[model samples]
Target: MVHTKLKYTPYFSISSFTFIMIRLMLLVCVLVSFAAAIPWLSPAYWLSPRAWPCPEDAAIAPCTCYADDDLNLFMDCQNLDSFQQLVDIFQVDFPFKKFGRLQISNSDLRDTLTAAVFPDGFMFREVIMFSNNFLDVDPDTFLPSKTELTFMEFSDPTPNFPLPAELTQLPELREAVLSVNCSEIPAWASDSLVTLTIRCLQDTEFPSPLNLSHLSALHLHHTNLLGVPVNSFVGSPGLQTLSLNNDQLASFDDGALSFTALHQLDISSNALTTMPQLTCGCEIQWLLGEDDATMPLIGIQNVTLVCDDGSGKFDDIRNVLDQLC
Candidate 1:
């Protein structure tokens, strides 16, 4: 075995060690910069606020955005003097495109409410308009929110007004209340419409041939309807409640109450001399029990109801003639 003297060599020199450390530090710096570029990886991003809850007040002046604790947003633009002001206000950029509810009441926004009145991407779940005089609305005014809108109301006697025929296009619309001056229910087919209330401000008869298949409740108030025509409710075969309160109705066609779903029929405060003939199916429970004289109906206790199923379906019309509580 030959033993040789081993030469002593250091693992690394000082310069070499320093160079390796520098390379390691550079790699760490690169990794740190990459992490900072990603918002989810940065700790500061999580601590910072994401966005402002509502729009700035000055940007939407006269119209206010209200944010609830549950984060629902509502916009109220009521009593605006000019229609131009409304158009100008919507021209500003809104932080949110969706609102829970929109209200415009007692505003002098005359002429036509076109699609330009709303922001480009604006949508509302509920829209209420009241006391807007001489204002005509475009058919496509609410087309953008056709899927989002659920409730709509146009009350308080708008003259020369027509119910927006475009409302039939909304698939999600559920309830609607309208005050008609000269409007009539256009040919519409809605599957989601459940309740409808129409207040006739002028002397008008009932609108026939309604196409609301999903309509469960129908209320006609303050109308000059003399009688209900035959097959008046043929389109709304699913209607369960029918109210003709506060109308000048004297006669009702037997075909009007021929649907099978109608259980509650209210003709209180009307001028009916005799009980209207019924041809519906289901147990009929007359709300009148021989003592209620406030209603104009005569011999209601003795009138016979014809049932399609021979179950003796009854009509439960409330005796409270003036008040539908």
Candidate 2:
């Protein structure tokens, strides 16, 4: 009986169909833009031409971003003269994703890395502050408050090393290459650090070997060391490799270096008149052979020693080791 006036409703209307299509296109566009903001994941990644690759928001102010084939993003702000300039960039065109590395050079002395500037939370795996005129960071405002950075390097153009006044402990920092004018290791330097490379202008010995027992590799470059003090390396039993290179060191104190189990020692390019005594049980790795008198070292079986009488006495040092050791 109801079929007498049965009429079929239009299953789909033109307006409704158009609306659904528009919504789907909008969703696709959102996804595409989101991927594009992540640099390497973007569909246009291969289309853009750059060294290694390109990065998200390359147009951001006072900085240039680059992406590698490994999907690592590097932010270069060498052109920016101050931290305030960087802050001004993020205040306007911040990236959607955190950067993998940040490089800032030729910047001002007042530039500091902290939450007040990068309020969105500065997350970086590596950082480089190179060729800077000065690095005048305030106490405790040098690093991000929330994020944990791993590696940091610096190159100061100024005469001083530009060491921070109050170097608050950075817990997540593992490796650091700092250029400072410190006569001794700073108290604020993190003890949890693994690799410590200090480029200083001091002729005195490093702060204290006891303070850096946790270090595995210790490199002191351009430190202007007159000599490593006696027992300077007494407490660094954990140090596997020690390098005192590119300095003004005239000599290492007698018994100045006594590592429990050192694997390698590099005392190259220094003005050393004699070699320090190696304690018993200390391992050695000879970088130069005994006959290589030009370098003033002996190529021992397991250890490396630098005994330059400058009179072809390298053989004498080797003979001594061969007899006693």
Candidate 3:
């Protein structure tokens, strides 16, 4: 058997391998150079912090790209004339798990904030809009399916205020502060409202049949109220705090003190000459009243009376109540 001797050329094999490696290196360099010339070709080059178009002394870092959830916390479209801008900004589906508070205050929002502006599952817990005229919005403009909203503060500039009935759909609402130009309470309120603070109720009657069974705090400060009827708070079983200070209340009917669960009551700095016999039975802890009567409160602690006589001598009201308790 004649076996042929195989030619072993190590130099030739090494030369071929080196040539292939050199060609691969040259190809990689050309690709990289081409990517560097284009603005949107390389992600690393696009994301470089030095390439951002922001001012040198800016407090925030320059950002050309944003996550889907970053824009939900704050949206200020003050005097934005185009409706498309409003729709584009609010149309993004913001992740609810990341956002907790949203503020759209002092914005000249036009008719672009309809119900379709926000996603259906938006869950904002707090929303504040001071001096935004949303009265022209449809009643169902903010009809969200599920909202974790706890508070809403809206200050309107127009006198003919229109409260939407869709507010009652929010099951978790706790506080609503409305500073409107109207002189009376909006008739379109729901029973789910617990804390209401109205600052501009002038020449308006305390709307009769106010459902306050679940209300805990009520503030009517600086609202021109002539007189609250006796039966205004008749059904508020869970009322704890009542503030009617700095109003034109000449007198309170006996029904004002009918809340059994009341704990703190403030009726100071009003035009009152006599105190209403609050029938809350010893549950009241703080009674801030005006000292215009001859006899002080017989039983109450932490009493602060604002009197014209300047004597602060009604300190003995708590001592009398302590003996009875």
Candidate 4:
């Protein structure tokens, strides 16, 4: 039982050991918190405006009711400048509450929104997605329950998303702006839309046989509409403004827009050698028929019947028509 050499193991009291364990745990917690603050590591948190970084000089003022003025939230990501940056800033599946108006002007968020990025269950009054360079938007732009919106706008210049006809189910929907080369006018658009602005991206003619009986404004800009076709503005009794400006309209049909009631017609900057007569009742305030002299119409209060050939001095439509003749 005699030991030649004895090595002793260090031991601590209960309180001392507990203190050491607590310090180790605190160190792990600090590391975890630092890791979560990394934007790339925690994409969902940084994408949120609530968790976004602010300047050190911000002084940490905190108070908010409205997002900005009448708008509940305004996400101005246009400065992001790239698709990847937009994705880094806005993570998918971020939960959110209902907002009055949410205006997202992103130049880089051109991704096809097939899945829910933001919590779409929050019913919104208006949602504006605009100015993206190119976006191939999917059919379910917003959630089904969110479809009961008042106004929805997708004003990307080269958007390939077809107008989701499901928007017609929105009982309160009024206006929509889209940029897509549609082969045919969205069928259900006649249900609740009062104003529509479509900038066709392809070299195609405007879809025919439109029946927007309640539409007040129809803007078909920058397309290959080879003239206002017969029955094109049919059944739109309340149609007030018809804008087919800056397009490939070669000629207007005599039966074009005969059934509708137009108050302001804009056929500016088109290739037109002839101006077909119209029967739309009401004195149009702005009859903008560029590159043409013969102003043929039912009634026009203020008309700009001038040529794009750098000669516009006549203040009267009659004088301009006389010069062309």
Q: Write the per-residue lDDT of candidate 1 for residues 1-325, one digit (tens) a residue.
A: 9999999999966798899999999987887788777545555544655433455677777888777887778888877888888888888767677989988878887667777788679998998988766456665678789879998887654453333564577889899887756444445668889999877666665557777989999888666656677777888877878878788877666555455456566777877766566533332223332334522233244355443243432223322321343
User: What's the lDDT of the predicted structure labeled candidate 2?
Assistant: 0.60
What lDDT would each prediction earn against the true structure?
0.68, 0.60, 0.56, 0.56
The per-prediction CA RMSD against the true structure, in angstroms, equals: 8.3, 7.1, 8.3, 14.1
Q: Write the per-residue lDDT of candidate 4 for residues 1-325, one digit (tens) a residue.
A: 8878877866954688899999999987876687676544464555655633321112211212235544354333334466555444434333344556656564565566543544335456777777655557666656553445777777665445534555555667788777664544454545677998777666665556666667898888776566566776666667877777788887766656454245567777787667654322222222323323533342332323323233543245434444553
Instruction: Tell me which residue pairs clash in candidate 2.
Output: 161-180, 185-207, 284-303, 285-304
Candidate 1 ranges beyond 4 A from true positions: 1-51, 159-167, 276-302, 305-325
lDDT of 2 at 108: 65
Listed in order, each prediction's TM-score against the native is 0.70, 0.63, 0.59, 0.58
Model 4 lDDT on a 0 to 1 scale? 0.56
Question: Mind sharing the TM-score for model 4?
Answer: 0.58
Model 4 residue runs over 4 Å out of place are 1-76, 81-96, 145-147, 157-159, 181-188, 277-325
* TM-score, structure 3 vs. true: 0.59
Q: Which stretches of candidate 2 lie over 4 Å from their true place?
A: 1-59, 69-71, 81-83, 107-115, 145-147, 157-168, 187-192, 202-205, 274-325
**Candidate 2, after superposition: displacement of residue 38 in Å?**
15
TM-score of 2: 0.63
The digit string of per-residue lDDT tens for model 3 on 101-121 reads 545555455442456766555
Residue-level lDDT for 37 in candidate 2: 67
The residue-by-residue lDDT of candidate 2 on 1-325, one tens digit each, is 5558778899876788899999999998988888866665675665666433433455555578777777777778866666567777666544434667878787663644444665655567777877656544433443553155677787663333333434334666677798754566553344566787887655545554445546788887677766666666655567777777778877666567666556567777876665655443313323323455533234322233345454644566655655655
